[model samples]
Target chain A: MPAINLLDKFSRFSDQWSPKVIAELNGQAVKLAKVQGTFVWHDHAEEDELFFVVRGTLLIDFEDRETVRLEPGELYVVPRGVRHCPRTEGEEEVWLMLLEPISTKHTGEVEDARTVRTYDRL
Target chain B: MPAINLLDKFSRFSDQWSPKVIAELNGQAVKLAKVQGTFVWHDHAEEDELFFVVRGTLLIDFEDRETVRLEPGELYVVPRGVRHCPRTEGEEEVWLMLLEPISTKHTGEVEDARTVRTYDRL
Candidate 1:
């Protein structure tokens, strides 16, 4: 497999809230997504999700009213079964690298219009 | 859990080839290491390893004589049970983020003076 360049992959798509799989290792899929506005509250039943900020800032709001803010070159992991919503604060688009199990659903247990069941492999 | 800043974590250590765990997600450990020079060739029997270059460049050499060169913002995964060695060229030190199983041994099946059985959590 060739080396995956994060920025080059991000330049391929412009859709928001849609994840594109870049690589798979140890049963986990490494995905990149361009996100803006707010996402729905959802939780994966048995998979932990890692969010690594590649560009811009990201705010993750939990059901308990706790918020985790991530900047570029930072990462945060949301444990399984924790309901959270991810969104950007301003007009800037956020570039995120997500790591989760291959079996993980795009929107976890909650499916809405923003749900992307099939992800394109970049 | 607090968001982990890659640069801040990297600033806390200067040891080469020693991995410092920063986060644990889904039974997998996220580690950071500053590496220079050559490392022993080893392979993990039951775990795949991911190498993400945070700064500088990295070269991964496989037993089959294949080499993968990674630059900043690039990532490569070495499949399980593949004999490989990681090294950096020139005088610059490479910053790397490694993802592997929690139970994975640093040196794999080979134990030598450079082996690190216990990694400090940053």
Candidate 2:
């Protein structure tokens, strides 16, 4: 397989909060997404989600109202069954690398308008 | 858990080829290591290894003589049972983030002087 470039992949799509699969290792898939504004509060029942900030900044808010702010070159892992919502402040776009199981649902058990059931493989 | 800064983690250790576990998620461990010079050729029989270059450059040489060169922000995954060796050229230190099963052995089936049986969790 060829090398996956994060910047090149980010240029492929303009939609926010949608994740595009870039590569799969073992049973986990590596996805890239450009996010802005606020996402819905949701949690995966069985799969843990890993978010790596590639550009800009990201804020992950938990059910307990605790917020974890991540800058470029920082990462955070949300354990399974933990309710969390990811959002970004201002107008700056945040580039994120998400790692989770292939069977993971984008919005977990909550199916809202922003939920992406089928992700494009880049 | 707090946010994990890649640069801060890289600064905690200076040893080469010794992987330090930084976080755990979904039965997998995220490790960081600084490497320079060549490492022994080995392969994980049951686990696939994901290598993400955070600083400098890395050259992964396969047993078939195929080499994959990775730059900063670039990632490559070595499939299971694939014999490969990681090396770096010049005098620069290479910072790497490795993702694999928590039970994965660093040196695979080979045991040499460079093998790290125990890894420090940072």
Q: Each model's fnat? A: 0.85, 0.70
Candidate 1 runs further than 4 Å off: none
Q: Which structure among the candidates has the greatest DockQ? A: 1
What is the clash count for each candidate, in the order shown? 0, 0
lDDT of 2 by residue, A19-92 (tens): 99988887999999999999999999999999999999999999775799999999999999999999999999
On the 0 to 100 scale, the lDDT of residue A44 in model 1 is: 96
Residue pairs in steric clash, candidate 1? Answer: none
Highest lDDT scorer = 1
lDDT of 2 at B6: 91
Clashing pairs in 2: none
Model 2 TM-score is 0.97
Task: Please write out the lDDT profile of model 1 over residues B1-119, one tens digit for every residue.
Answer: 88899999999999999999999888899999999988999999999999999999999999785699999999998999999999999888999999999999998999867899999
